[model samples]
Target: MKKLTAFIMLIALTGCSKLSMDNYQLLKTGMSYDEVTAIIGKPDSCEEALGTRSCVWGDEQKQIKAAFLAEKAMLFSHQGLK
Candidate 1:
């Protein structure tokens, strides 16, 4: 009933997240964090340490991840994006 309908809607909405193969491809090395966020929106979570940062968008099963050094993008990868 209503609960089931809500559940399905939740899944549908999550599926429409900004994290996708197309957006992930827009990433490039040397892009600043602000530039990266402008493309994929803010990350779901991020961690910083030792003058570097790691950020992730979306969830565990479907997500885009980036590693930054000197405040610029150094590497980017994704999981379960389709």
Candidate 2:
């Protein structure tokens, strides 16, 4: 069962990455994108409206994500993707 053992080890290592999101921080209601990025680093995705924006970190595999807001600067948003 060397293959079985290898599969288990792979799963364990993958789970470690998912579990490490506990260290992330949430974006506040009025915080700007720059400030949020400063706290949580760059985001993997983002969304933007006329005067609002949101940034997201992490991916579907990892739930540890953050968001940010901006008024005039370019904003990132998650939309239109199926």
TM-score, structure 1 vs. true: 0.78
**Which candidate ranks first by TM-score, i.e. highest?**
1
| TM-score against native, each model | 0.78, 0.43
Candidate 1 residue 58 C-alpha distance from true site, Å:
1.0
- lDDT against the true structure, each candidate: 0.93, 0.50
Q: Tell me the spans in candidate 2 whose CA falls farther than 4 Å from its real position.
A: 1-27, 64-82
Clashing pairs in 2: 46-76, 46-77, 47-76, 47-77
Write model 2 residue lDDT over 1-82, tens digit each, in one string: 9999999999996565322323332434465656656555666766666645555566664443333334423333322222
Q: What is the lDDT of residue 54 in candidate 2?
A: 56
What clash count does candidate 1 reach?
A: 0
